[model samples]
Target: MRYVREFKGFAGIRLESDDIGTADDPSIILLHGFGQTRKIWEDVAVGLEQAGRHVINVDLRGHGGSDWPSDARYDFDAYVEDLRAVLGQMRTRPVVVAAMHSGWIATAALAEDAATLASGLILVDPQSESGAQSVRACAEELSASVGQGLAKPDYDERLLDIFDVDGSGARLLDSAPHINIPVLVVRGALGSGHRAENSTGYADAFPNAEAINVDGGGLLVNAERTEAFNGLLIDFLERKQPRFIPEYRSGSDARTLRDAMGCFATGITIITAHDADGKPIGLTANSFTSVSLDPPLLLVCIANNAGSAETLRSAQSFAVNVLQIGQQPVSNLFAGKGEDRFAGTRWEVGEYGAPILPSSLGIFECTRNALHEAGDHFLLVGKVEKASFEPRRDPLLYFRGKYRRLHFT
Candidate 1:
């Protein structure tokens, strides 16, 4: 069964979508590229519904049945906010599938809160980084096609002049690492002209992403290779956005158990102290908690084989620096190998002689209270001698093995 559905988009604008399949099933939202309407997803929607998924094929602002804003606001941010509004209104998080230029909107919309918005993402023939000249060329081609009656005037022509692509590519690149959900990038012949290195870099930016090349498929892979594209889509959905929940019993693979543990979000921290050689050493850790308030006790678990584990164990004092949103690069530097972590960071000695990252959201200077050996790791408990926190800063969070920011309602 299929019917038309209306959604309240950015600024309460009415956006239209083709609602297919039963609502009980897993859901998917399909977004088309510029100069196209939701009608382009007709065949794909039917295929997804038959495969036990609900589908919402959307018409962006100024296209198809959706409201074309009288304000003529067709900027990139408008499109991004529209998608986020649609996701917020959905009963369940759906896997978003976008083609060509729409991929930029989908990625930007989900970048900040991917785990909360959508379960997965699929990009079809996404551009690496389209410049102003490339966009103008595309507009000229679209106009020529429309003049020759090769395309229908289904969208507003004013969008060509108003839709801004400036700085969008760089923003997309910076947003990639934050979109931690499963992403499938399907490259077709349409983007063959894009530099291979840039294309690879774009796809690799996502922490959890896969890419496939559809050779010989024309500009529009969905239209030219419908069957093949549908096959890949179904397969990714089954694996990443499965209908059933995953369960892990004891004694299963350690990886599965680790994944289960990753579900619990924790604040990121850097355990810092000076080794016997009077050199500052630190490593990123999330296994930290305050054990007692009466005695001001806290504990951090470190892998036994870690380079800093021995030094930290013998040290009389150490500092736990709770990171903030601006210190993600610092966290990476401490976690990474073969880098002078202190050389790249700003720091000062705490009252307890421990290296404290001054800009951290919170700092706990502690004296070594106790140490115990846990399986594969050592528990380093400390008696907090002093503590300081920045009340105005937000914490950096970690969840499901990915970095996340605190999302405010």
Candidate 2:
């Protein structure tokens, strides 16, 4: 099912949207390029809906059924603000799918608060960081290709004003590091205006991002190769595993179940404690999650055969250090069998007598609360005694058998 709705956008402009699929499904917000409307996403939205996703195709201000403000305040900031307003209205955080000029707006928005606003990002044929001259040339070409009957008479002219203004492209470059969400950059193999350098640049800026080119596709890659685009989009979503769906069943293969569980991304942590001999012992683990808040409880599973298993089992207290993006080497160090893991690692003794890694994204000092036998692993539950985190640091992530960094939305 699909329906049209209006949203209050930036500067009092009314943005129109086509809402599709069931409200209970995972949400995906699609933004079209300049001089285009929400209708451009019709085919893509249909495919997404079929895959059990709720899709919202939005028309930016000054285009399609959206209000064309007489004030003529169409700039990069204005576009970003409009998108922010639309996201604010969604019931859940959505995976933003943006193309060309709209991709610029999405980048700026994600740079501001990626952790809170978006779950993932898909940028198609994003606009290049070319100067005003290139933009003006592109505007002229677009105006000629799209006749008066196709777009608003003033769209091209107003769009030129936006491109001519300096700083939007620079801001995008500066804000790239702040985007801490998974991102996919898709470009058309034979596209113009969407430069290869710019596409690769976006991927390089992000902590966790990958780039791909669609064969025989141009600027409108989604429309040109609908099937390929849909497949790519769906695969990325499944790997991200934004919303957990229970699929437990009896008699499932152990390896298969483990593979399925890997779909759920988790932060890497090093569980540290002092053994009976007062030696600092630690092991890398991703099987750590909060269990309770009122009593501040958490748990980490350690393999019974692990070198530190006996130390952890006998320890009265421990610390879980959530690694940062810069700590991949540290995680590797602790995951290995031998070689002094803490020899060069900078750490300090916490109140609970556990070694707390320096510069970790988060540290949870805990008192050993309980231990339970589970298959080949022992579940060690802990009551958190103290917790601290670095707000500016991005977490080290693991998904689908690989280490991942947060890609700014």
Candidate 3:
């Protein structure tokens, strides 16, 4: 739930992301029910991502940030069209997931693009016509629990809010046949008696689908029973995968060394200084190591091809600013090739003519003690002219090649 989140979408139609973790394996796309915003699935998405499945929370048209139809009638086809446009904007073509009312609609559209749209599909708790009586019963049972606290609505209100339709029976019957994929129809265990029956009817309608029951769930199963639902969805998506996009970096030329470094965890440091003529020179480096604690000797390596390498190599002194785990933008700027790399960066001069980045986990103002040639890089050793360190913040890491934070806390 505390996952780092962001809002991104068109026409102010907000899309939310809570990266529980990276998606090295399975990716997921989550769709919310009608009248509900994308926030409904935020908790679930974070849980799935933390479990290693890439999860995205989708906002339906006229619901979240998606543009609303000037016309009052918000139907299934309009919802599907919104997804088509949204998918086109996604960084990755995600596995579509529809909860309850959205389940049937998303399934149909995805099946149409089945070949290239997704690596898998996760059909969350959805209602079906064949199971209307059961769902009705389940609805009634749930009505008993929060009847005093919440303003319980009638069947018509429930149907209209969830399916964007006034009627429930005909709607359920028509929607069931639309879902023909290997669906997982999840039902809340604490739901009305009719819900269980409707879920069974739904399972019977879809030949490739299975029915899973999550205890203490209700109409808003994805939100109320988020943990259970997320677990089931992640498990299902991971069970099988299609190599729609075999590589994370599409072409060989676009593959970054950082993607490969994600395998080996390493520490972070920023090396800065002045060249022979006294102009400022610097770059962020994660390949920093302590040579000797006795004399407090340290070393930072710079790649020969790096833009600041020449200036740093010829300098008489340089400062080592060991960064904390969360300084992503700072690392990006220093590692990037741009004229205004330090435009927004906060830094100050050390005793040695070198720039010392603010709030670094540790700062070592040093004079060039030694330089050793490493393959394609130079290891520059520095004798501590001045030193400083902080305890609370953890050291940053550069593994396999991307900047990663220590997640122990």
* Whole-model lDDT, model 3: 0.62
Residue 258 C-alpha lDDT in model 1: 91
TM-score-better candidate, 2 vs 3: 2
Q: Which stretches of candidate 1 lie over 4 Å from their true place?
A: 130-136, 139-151, 189-199, 217-224, 245-409
**Whole-model lDDT, candidate 1?**
0.85
lDDT per residue for candidate 3 within 1-409, as digits (tens), equals: 2344444333334444444445454556777654455665666766675555666665555554544545433455555555655666656656777765566566656645553665455555565544433333434444554333335332233334433433544544454454444666676622332343535556766546666767663444434555656667767766555434324554464354444545567777778887677666778787778898767788987889988888878888899888887777778878777657556778888877788887888889998888999988999998888888999988777765556667521
Please give the clash total of every predicted structure, in order.
0, 3, 22
Q: What lDDT score belongs to each candidate, Candidate 1 first?
A: 0.85, 0.80, 0.62
TM-score of 3: 0.54
Evaluated with lDDT, which candidate comes out highest? 1
Measured on C-alpha atoms, candidate 2 has an lDDT of 0.80
Global Cα RMSD, each model: 20.1, 19.6, 8.7
Q: Model 2: how far is 132 from its true place, Å?
A: 7.3
Instruction: Please report how far candidate 3 places residue 58 from its true position, in Å.
Output: 6.3
